[model samples]
Target: MNEVANPGSSAVVLIGTAEYDHADVERVPSVSANLDDLYDALLDPGIWGVPAENITVLRDERDPASVYDAIRAAARSTRDDGLFLVYYAGHGFPYDDDLVLGLREVDPQFPDEKGLRYPKIRQATQLAIALRRVVILDCCFAGRAGREVLDAGDAVKQIAGRAEISAEETYLLVAVGPNELAKAPLNDRHTAFTSALLHVLTTGSETADPVLSIRTVAEKVIRRVVAAGHRRPEFRAANAAVDAPLVRNARLRPHDLTGVVLEATADVTDPELRGAVILVLRHNDSGALGVRLNRDFGPLPAALDGWRDHVSLPDRLFDGGPVAQDGFISLVRLREHEERPIRFTEVTGLLGSLPLSDAQQSARDRIADLRIFRGYLGWRPGALERLVTHGRLRITDTNPFHAAFARAPFTRTGS
Candidate 1:
């Protein structure tokens, strides 16, 4: 399950330098817009709803010490379970192998001395008591922060072992790789990466979970950035923090049961579907596809006898639905720590569908769970939504594994 950071206790610091003093470094007028749009996105009720009081915005800051002070205060103020977020959009001055944040007074000739060094930002974040921390960089060579901050196993740097800055709770979203430059078109309203991020936050993603995880947002942002022929962005998060909820999804509502469990309502008169437990394999604007979990379709077909022994509990072909009864759909859960295998379309988490032929003999040891279903339920684009809205099907939070393996029984219940 994805945990939502407590908005009231969380803190956000957004710093943007739209104007610079150095003659060599160009000013980014769009940076001011970036801060505004992100501030609005963070406060959107449908998104995170973080209180305005908890957020601080600094534009064209003249003093690097003030920036450090803001980060320090926010980090110290956030509670243990809250999230601490810091965002910087401006000129990134490369100092040796480290990246520095350019302020209004930054001197390109002496970047390390005039700019806010990465180590200062690291030290402030390391002092935070918050359980989860996020740092977003939208400047040239932003990815260098990843090498400096996220490589927790760095032997030379003993500070990387700090608890607050550990890999388990820290996440980095950089606009470009260490060698690439972030795009800031003069006429554009925001930098390329920030524009993509704001768009995803406001519009939300149809394929993501009900709550928007940072990882999901990063995936969409990276795709958009790459599609526009801009520098590719990078995302780094370790452990469960990868799936932590950054905000409520603006697109997928609770009634949209894509990759979710659905049980028939008790009052349903359809004998074939009543008391049915189903796992929706796919739901989109086109339609929905689901497989019945509890209904028994007798033993495995003779042609698929080879899979009978490898299937999970309740090893039998299931009466998936009325559509294409001759066809088969196989769901497999890959073992923990295993990378997604080829020829698999992930449904949710580690659960995914595998072609019968592909799973016949390969990577058998990596299979943690498996289920085979005959046929599947189908609904036109709006049909399933109407059914859900009218209470014919009850959306459930049941773990997908239970439905995949038929580990639990669904009773004829209320909507």
Candidate 2:
């Protein structure tokens, strides 16, 4: 069983709300919707290539106390090895040298509410002092959220070179540069900075590396934002390494590995029996390399539709191997016998059987769930081994986690 990994040390918090009851501007669905999208992106196991248990998400309509509690829990859970990510997306206003993140109840008449207090950048910096922190602020006037402006001579010292003595683990990325205002386009669902940020994350670039350096990602985001008709995004580091990587998971490039590939026609050949990630399989060729990934089980048998009251089977049937397209492939997970004659996919590790309806029903009852994919991914003979040897494919020693299928991918931080 591939169980999801727990958030041992890394934590993520996201806050997005546009319903400022006191403000003149009406609320927009995009604000909350974008935040939800961001939350999904961060929690995606495939995005970080780690288990989903390592992340947590908090959304709009949540009370400040609950929000703070979640943050506190994450902070306490990973005292020393903590990697914290905080994201805010909504209205922002300048307050002295810092900026304020407007809460839903904040009104223009009384923008500052004691109950919904603005978390100062300095406070965030202080929190960062105790952990590795990444902060993303997406709103108008966000650049002023940090320390006070310094004289030109002092600017370099205050913002750039002063690396010693201060909190050395915090980094910030704001939507716009200092004194620049962020624009919220009518047509675009997300702010320009945020849209660009998402594009860069999903786009597979040749120069992309696994370390996920903050500077690199920021630069790419800024460039993309400017190209998309927006001001450059602002980046700030507080006594931290500029090149420090962002993601805990190793970064993956495009040309890393070739997934599984099998012929549409059935053939019992050894050449068809290879791949680290199986793309396709025929049951006749490989005698049902059990528990295949990336193939959907067709419709369930009519007799067993409601017969098994407590168990759930896959909606679609699938060819467990590349050799038998029409034949049925079954997955069996039994409690009585721990060991069985089955080839596990390792990604999901359920045992496989060749067209055994009874065993299939039993397995369906035992696992009680299924994932159906249109096609599978596979590699030819020696292809996977060569990729691993050449450093193109990195095989993590950590085991696969089950939480990946629970939901789509999520982003740890948002623009």
For this target, which candidate reaches the highest lDDT against the unseen true structure? 1
Model 1 misses residue 384 by how many Å? 28
Expressed as tens digits, the lDDT of each residue in 19-129 for candidate 1 is: 998788898999999999999888754567677899999999888888899899999989876888999999997888889989998898788776889878978986778
**Over 4 Å off in model 1, which ranges?**
148-168, 238-242, 253-415
> Per-prediction TM-score, please?
0.57, 0.56
Question: Against the unseen true structure, what C-alpha lDDT does each candidate score?
Answer: 0.78, 0.49
Candidate 2 C-alpha lDDT tens digits along 110-193: 454511234643453344323566678788777776644232234446656555544345667889855777766776687677
Prediction 2 TM-score vs. true: 0.56
lDDT of 2: 0.49
Worst 10 residues of 1 by lDDT: 148-157
**Model 2 ranges off by over 4 Å:** 1-7, 49-56, 62-66, 114-130, 148-167, 240-242, 248-415
| Span of 10 residues, lowest total lDDT, candidate 2 | 406-415
